[model samples]
Target: MLRITTLLLILVAISSCSNKKTETEPLTAEHKAKIVGLSKDLIKSINDFDFSIVNSTWSNKAFKDRVSNITGTQKSVFEHIFEKDLKRKIKTGNLSIIHHINSTNGAASFFNLDHKDHHSELTILLTYNDNFNFFKYRIEIENQKPVLSDSYNFRDNLWYSEKIINSLRLASKHNAFSNDRRETNIAIHNSDQELLKGDTLEALYYLYDIPTTHQTGNWLSFRKLTLAQSLSDSVYASVMVTEYENNKSLYMKYLYHLYFSDSTDLEKVYDILSEELGESKTLDSLVSSGSFWD
Candidate 1:
């Protein structure tokens, strides 16, 4: 929590600093100082365990709506960790706000709080409004890397954002043998290679069993087999994505989709990757659905 005098001193310095600058139409220090103050108040309320203040402060933010969509189990978690952290008492010092302004939508603030632990928290967010000021805003204590990396991606028939799914790891697991295994196997059978192909209907049964504790000891996933099946039929027209041995390189690892006529005769097509993988956005479950990693 920030001391009352510390916040005042910081605000005064910002106000004085603004007086010396010739500003343009972009965000001004004076305007940002107000936002910082408001953000500080919210933090203050949270530290004091004053739910009313914390809740009422963001009356015009998108986070409030997102909070409403949180499930009961999710709520229980926040009450345990997030709520406790949000409301814990502590002495804070050296507060600074960085304002990032843009040509399009103006800017936001990152509330930098220096604490006794020699560590600091950098929070960034904004109460962005449309042309109509409809209270459509976002106030997140932004982090470049979230708590969860991969999560359960349940999809029926829509493209879900990778940012959301990756941010929550939800109820998911990394059984290096399940998802990739099963998907590969299904693709093999679909390609029509007798030897490479496994029991398709059987693999399908264990396909979604991942992200669980149930140990269904059966063959799962098959891409090589999928290609082999294609080869057996004379024309192997399928997508193939190569995995990098060292995925930490970011650019080294990739997700590929390809089609081929035979093992030797092939058409290299449809490929995309980025040096930016684990960004806060998301890594969609489309990979599991055989969308691009076919």
Candidate 2:
């Protein structure tokens, strides 16, 4: 009996040591629970189409802090959208709590929300404010087609991520990240004619001179230069690999349709986009033509 007792105590000591050595990051369970609660409240506000409920759930100071920045009628318009169709548009297909690399000042919870109807997935960023009083939430959506770019931010007015990218990378395997990733460059010599085009390096250069991107995952950011997705065969690429010979007008028209559709009167924006495309396409073609590639 004494031998058995000694053995049991040895096992208990081993169990304690193992538990102490486990690598779970340090965080107060109570604080973590609060973070989850706030995140849920924010999502619930959005799902129920109740912006007023947000006023109730969030601290008055935080509410004023966020809303005060909204200058005018834009607030009303923005509020209306959230109070109405925002939830109806994207359903919470799935949600999971993601750990933060370090939980210092406050907390950040990353969740993947599936909107199966739209064939889109949203990576929701819920960041607890300094006091853990409320959450500053932003959502980034990637569609079924898997586009990762910031170009649509101008059109959609929906903010993506400046944080929560690493967790996103862990979710998608095809996500590629490298400093060597080259953006397509299209340079214009004359406003009317292309000096050079096609930088094999960056797809964004093909999209624009300034590479503004939305997160495709953690490692990739892409913008939609052409709003419309064109069906390109190897034959098509071989025939007009150079910008001078490429169908720029057709591509532009397709892009216009992608963002504005056939009926939108947002022409000034489209004109700016078109002019930028002309410059980007030129540089891209010149770079892509090198013999290093087929």
Every candidate's CA RMSD: 21.2, 21.6
Tens digits of per-residue lDDT, candidate 1, 126-202, equal 22232100001122221211111111111111111232232223423333366744554454354444333564433
Residue-by-residue lDDT tens digits, candidate 2, 1-294: 999999999976764553331222233444344445545665554544445433333222221222323323333444465457533332221111122212333233334433232122333333333221111232122221122121112222222322212223322332235221222112212211321334322332333342333222212211221211232444223323322132234333333343334534333434554353333342233223431100
List clash counts for every candidate, in order: 19, 31
The window of 10 residues in a row where model 2 has the poorest summed lDDT is 143-152
Number of clashes found in candidate 2: 31
Which runs in model 2 stand beyond 4 Å of their true positions? 1-27, 52-294
User: In order, what lDDT does every prediction score?
Assistant: 0.30, 0.31
Best by lDDT: 2
Alpha carbon lDDT of residue 263, candidate 1?
22
> Candidate 2: RMSD over Cα atoms?
21.6
